[model samples]
Target chain A: MKNSLLSIYNIAKKDLLIELRNKDVILSISGFGTIIIFIFSFAFDVGSSLSSSTAAGILWSSISFASITGINRSFMLESENDTLEALIMAPISRDIIYLGKVVGNFIFITISEMVILPIFAILFNFSILSLEFITCCLLANIGFSVVGTLFASLSIKVRAREVLLPMLFLPCIIPILFSSIEATSMIFQGKGWNDLSIWFQLTVAFNLIFLIFSLFISNVIYED
Target chain B: MSNIIKNKLLTCSAIFMFINLYLIFIWVPTEANQGAIQRILYIHVPVSQISMLAIILVAVSSVLFLWKRNQFWDKIAISAAEIGLLYGTIMLLSGILWAKPVWGVWWTGEAKLTTALILYLIYVSYIMFRNYFPTGSQGQRIAAIIAIIGALDTPLIYFAANLWSEAHPPIVLGPASENDSSFSSNDMRIVWLFSTITFMIFFVYLLRIRYKLQDTISKYLTNT
Candidate 1:
């Protein structure tokens, strides 16, 4: 188990380094994300008084789209180098590879979200310093990234990888979107975290279940 | 000779489906409030039920394919997914038609309908995902893994619809739900049950023909 964790850590670190050097994964996503936020701002003329209530939807939409770009690039890059096959051929377990990629993708998406959230808050004039808002976003972020990573690995080998990822991903991320919006909205409404415990529970359950199932399925797919 | 027999069976099932539709439209008693529009339930509910069953079959058979690594199980799963898509499409069409008159809108954020749509899209993407890989070259294993992970999204979509505040109520039993008691009177029950049986028989019959068709296509395509 220790060896597995160490292997995954090394793999994830290597992935991070590669991503840092290229930076296309992050820049393109954040660029596209910025455009989406501008569209939202122009489309909805709530003025400078845009309610914090609307922030949740905007935040999630931006993150979801940015994550897709990130996921697409992550696998596309790996495949470019034939790195995926090499990792599979190595002595490492398939689940460890899955874990490494999922964690790596999760971190990349988190950074994108970290950038987008504050910008969204500033442009829309919504408060973002609340602990509740941050926590809700984090849980939903993990859930989306977990499921997205699994699908990214699944999608990369497909003929229409870019088009297929969002088609396969959007529906699956609906739950995360729901919980995130609800929890964040509650916070915006001045309700405490305790009020949104059910959403949090749902988020956690979704994360755990997808983690286990994706691990198993990734293993089977890798073996092939 | 076997192919001819299978084609005949398919033709017979189509005839049965046509007769069932006639009974639903012309013979079945209409509701007091919803009137003739309620007649749509006879077809819509059953198709939706069978679609869910078809997807479950795909999921389970995919798991079997992964476990046994057998082409036969993969074929079964592919067949089931194809049939599932058929039913899913029918369900979506009938659902939209029914929703237009009842809800005063074509589509709403109803829990059941939204999730059903999401489920349909997920499986459709699965089929599309299958096209990415080369056939008979570990494609089955990759497809199976995808089908399984993709199928996992269905239940979460369903539960999310229930747990989150949504316009549509949870479907507890049958396709309409116990909440739809007003719609599920004894008169409705009889026709609905008949429609369910008709759809299931039609589904099985269609699945068998599809599997045979797939066998032929695969044989010809692979030049085996």
Candidate 2:
């Protein structure tokens, strides 16, 4: 288990390293996210209507779409190089590979959310210092990336995979999207944890379920 | 040897379908509220239940195919998916048809309807992916992986509606909430039970035939 964990770390590090050098995935994801926020801001006049209450939804949705863009490009390197084939043939277990990709995606999206959240707040005229809302944003972002990465790995091999990943993923993410939006609303409204506990529990439950499931299937999926 | 068994199974399926049609259309009385329109429930609810069951069968068969490395399980998974898609479409159509009279719209932004629509899209893409890749090409393995990932939506689609506020049809069976009174009386209970069983039998009959059809195509292709 320790060896597997270390392998996962290395694989995750490798993914990050590649992305850093190319900067293509991160740039596009954050850029796309920024454009979406600006477009929505103009269309809905979100900049003026922005309250602590609605701020969280805008931030999370922007982050979610950004991550989808990043995940699509994250695999472009592997698809071009056959490096994924070599990784599978290595001594590492497939679960490590799955975990590595998920974690790397998690980090990538987290960065995007960090950038998007503040800009969203400023644009919407909401304060960004609420601790509870920030924490919820972090957790929800992680949950989304974990599931998104798994779907990316699964769909990146298909034809018109760009369209297929979101089609396959957005439905499953509805619950996460709901809870995140709801929990954020509650926090903005100054509601107590008693009112929002179910959403948090749901987020935790969904993350664990998808993590275990994705790990088990990654071996079959990654095999040639 | 198996030809006789196949013939017998097909005959049994035809009889079961005949009995199901008689039970649902001729015997069961219309509900008090929805009247003639409520009859669509007889078709919609049964087909939706069977589609969920068929999806489970597809998931289980795919897992078996991966574990055992047997083409038989793969073939079974493929066929079950085909049947599941067919039933899923019927469920959605009947659902929309039922909604038109009762909900005053052909479709609603209800969580259940949205999730079901997404489920249909995911599996449909899975089939499209399979077709895009040539037989015996790497796409078969790729398609199976997508099938497994898409199957993850089954549970999410089932529960998302309950977690979110929607105008979708309420759950009728199991631990009834304060809404239990809506389905009061022994007569309603018996009819519900009868309809559920009738649906299960009809599902099995369809599955048996679909599986044989799959076997024939696979065998014929191999022989040619």
Candidate 3:
């Protein structure tokens, strides 16, 4: 267990270091996320009767779309350098690699969300900086990162991965998207934790199920 | 041997389909509220149920494929997903037809309807994954992973939609209560059961043919 944890940490650290050096994924994702928010504001006429729920929906939709780009980049980076092949040949288990990528993708997506949220708040004229809103974001991100990384790895070998990743990832993340939007909307409405607890629990449940499930099946994708 | 079995199953399904058509149109009484349009339920409900069952079958076969590393289970998983997608498409279309006259709309954000659409999309992506990565262990592995994750995430999808629909009460047109005895009548119950069984048998029949077709294609590919 200890060794596996170390391996996972090491792999995640390597990915983070590479990302820090390049900064391509984070920049592109955050840029795309900002563009989506801007477009949504214009398209939806955000200044009018934009409810908090609508704002929440727009915010999540941007994050979800941007995260798809980020997921593709992360896996593309690994596969580009044949880093995935080398890692597969290494002593580390496939689940360890999966956990590592999940951690890495989670951090990347979180960073992009940080950039997107402020822009979303400014454009949509809503304050989403509350603790409850952030908590919901974090929970939803965990579910997204876990499931996204698994699918990203799976789609890495496909020819039209850019198109395929979102197709595969979007439906699976509907629960997270719904829960996050609902919880955030409720938080904005001054609903207490008691009212929003169900959404939070649902997000956490999705995260747990995907996390454990990805761990168990991650090896199948890499194994010949 | 397989050809003989396939022919027998095809004959059985055709016979059952004819019986189902007769039972739906003539034997079953028209619903009081929905009138003749409600007869779509006989086909829609059974196909929808079978589609869900096919997804479960895909998940089980995926597990088996991953564990055994056998192409047979992989074929079964893909074949089941394809057949599931067909049934899901039928369910969605038949649902829209039923809803048009009944609900006065082709679509609604209702929980069950939305979940079924998402499930259909997920199945489509699963087939797309198979097509995109045609010949590798990578493709098979990724498809298996999708099947497993998609199955695990389905209930969460349903629950999230349920929660969402609760916040904004849907404009429901059909039954007012959950336990409305539309099917509680002896005749309705019998027809419902028979249709469900017939659909299940039909699902198996399609699955067998699809599996055989996939097997033949793979064999031909390898030989050439």
| Per-residue accuracy of model 1 over A1-224 as CA lDDT, tens digit each | 88988998998899889888988777766777877888898888747566655777887787788788888888888888888899999888888998998888878877777778777877887777888877787787788778888877766567778888898888788888888877777777788967888888888888999999877666665764
The RMSD (Cα, Å) of candidate 1 is 3.3
lDDT of 2 by residue, B77-143 (tens): 7777788898898898888776666656677555667667777777787777676555653555666
Per-model DockQ: 0.65, 0.37, 0.80
For residue A15, model 1's alpha carbon misses the true position, in angstroms, by 1.4
lDDT of 2 at A188: 70
The backbone clash count of each candidate, in order, is: 0, 0, 0
Best by TM-score: 3
Per-residue lDDT tens digits for candidate 3, residues B120-194, read 898898898888886867678778878887888789999999989988776746542343344536788778888
Best by DockQ: 3
1 versus 3: better TM-score goes to: 3
Against the correct fold, how does model 1 do in TM-score?
0.92
User: Where does model 2 exceed 4 Å of error?
Assistant: A1-6, A47-58, B1-28, B104-118, B133-153, B156-160, B166-213, B216-224
TM-score of 2: 0.82
Selected candidate, larger TM-score, 1 vs 2: 1
Candidate 3: tens digits of C-alpha lDDT, residues A1-224: 99999998999899889989999889878999999999999999966868888888888898999998988998898888888989899988899989888888899989888899888878877777778888898998898898888888887778899999999899999999998888888887888889989999999988898888777766676774
TM-score of predicted chain A against the true chain A, for each candidate: 0.95, 0.93, 0.97
